[model samples]
Target: MEAIAYERATNIADAVKAAREPGTAFIGGGTNLLDLMKGGIAHPLKLVDITHLRDDGLDAVRALPDGGIRIGALMRNSDAANHTLVRERYPLLTQALLAGASAQLRNMATIGGNLMQRTRCPYFYDTAFAACNKRAPGSGCAARDGYQRLHAILGASEHCIAVNPSDMSVALAALDANVQVVGPDGARQIPIGEFHRLPGDRPDVDTTLRPGELITGVDLPPSRLADRAYYLKIRDRASYAFALVSVAAALQVQGDKVAAARIALGGVAHKPWRASIAENVLIGRTLDDETLREAAAAQMRDARPQHGNRFKVALAERGIVRAVNVAAGREPAGVTGAPA
Candidate 1:
């Protein structure tokens, strides 16, 4: 790790000011940032600890008057998952959060940090590889011609194929969440769908957040899918393994017909891959196995997987079908190495 200076801001303004300095980064749970620093992937000269920003009440989860939920940035993953409002109103978010890392890590990971978590690409972590575009821009993407079983299948540029590793962000995308950010210039709202950017030409910029901007909280809009939601994760292990294919499915069913639907895929792109095309295929249709298959197929129609990860195309298809079925009350939810 490089030599660093640490400063804990007692307020949001101070935090923003500290972060404005060149080569400065904000510290949240330090779950992801610390790992990158240890790997020499991140070399910040100063750390502005904003884990206790007072302006936004950064650790509360409260119900909004409009039936939405507001989650503060510093709220721990475990607490947010178990919060009464979250469990009762955003079960898909709860399920996705629980499906991630172990209990100990969840207890330390914050909502902001989780959304800002880095990719788990092996090449991005090993300094021995000098071709990771995310690590060293313009060098090249090692995963393009290397081990790609866990790389992206959609929204990938020729320069990078790394996938976003946050299951919670996937659920947020499906829930139509909005991120509140405060920076040197003041505040702004970024729709969750537009928050994480595709790895177009600039793979180094994972999110749309500007320098010195701090994510204050997330707002989840009103939805009726709370009672009809499912999170399915498929990985190499039964637990504690990163997802190879994961789906966050939620539906609003009117009698036997689908009134509204949201499907988002993790581990398949640079950001939470929203299956909007599949969603369009299911809305107003009769909920059934055939409809589920068609919707899943629609989502996979544009997938472009590389050599070792082509199997993900099929795995994602099956997982999407299963997730939507489970969300529609036609299937049971399960966890493990296989799509549930």
Candidate 2:
């Protein structure tokens, strides 16, 4: 570990100001950032402690006047998963939060930290390899031709094929949540679909957040799909493993037909992939096996798989079909690992 400076911020303004300095980072739960620092993947000269900024409602979960929910960025993952509003109105998010990491991690991880978590690609974590574009821009992407079973199959550039590893983020994309952030310039809300960035030429940038911008909370709009939502994660083991493929599926059904659909995929892209193509194929259609298959096919139509991750294309397709089937009530929802 490298020598570092620490500052405890009493307010959001102070935190933002402190973070404006070069090589400064905000710490909420320090779940991911601490690990990266220990591994020498992240080397910040100074750390701004934002976990103590609770007077700004940064650690509370409250209801919006529009019947939506606002989740505080500093709220622990386990707390958010079991919150009354989250469990009753946004079960998809609850399921996603529970499906990630473990009970211990969920208790310590914050919502904002989860959103900022880096890709779990081995090339990025192991500094010895020296070919990860995300780790060192303009270098190269070793995963492009190296071990890639856990890599991306969508929206990948030649420079990088790493996938976002957060299951909660995939659910947020499906739920159409908005991230509330504040910085030196003031505050703004970034749509969940646009929060994370694709591994374009700039693979080093993980999100669209501006410099010194601090994520304060997330707003989830009201939706009728709460009762008909599901999160499915496929991994090498049942627990404590990163996903090979994960799907967050929610459907609004009218009578026997689909009125609307929200589907997001994880472990397949640099960002949480919103399956708009699949949603377009399912609207107004019956939830039949053939329809599910068609939706899955449409979703995977543009997938570009790497050498070692070609299996992910088919795996993602099946995962989508199964997830949508469960969400549409066409099939029973099976157990998805142990809850955090």
Q: Highest lDDT: which candidate?
A: 2
Error of 2 at 297 (Å): 0.3
lDDT of 2 by residue, 25-44 (tens): 99989989989998999999
In the predicted model 1, the residue pairs found to clash are: none
lDDT (Cα) of model 1: 0.91
Determine which window of 10 residues in candidate 1 has minimal summed lDDT. 331-340
Q: Each candidate: how many clashes? A: 0, 0
What TM-score, over all chains together, does every model reach?
0.97, 0.98
Residues 1-340, candidate 1, lDDT per residue (tens digit)? 3589999998988998888889999998999999999889999999998876777558989888899989999999999999999999999999999989888989999999999999999999999999999999999999988999999999999999999999899999999999999998899999999999998888999999999999999999988899999998898776677899999999998988889999999999999999999999999999878878888888899999999999999999999998888887787765523433
- Model 2 residue 327 distance off true place after TM-score fit, in angstroms: 1.4
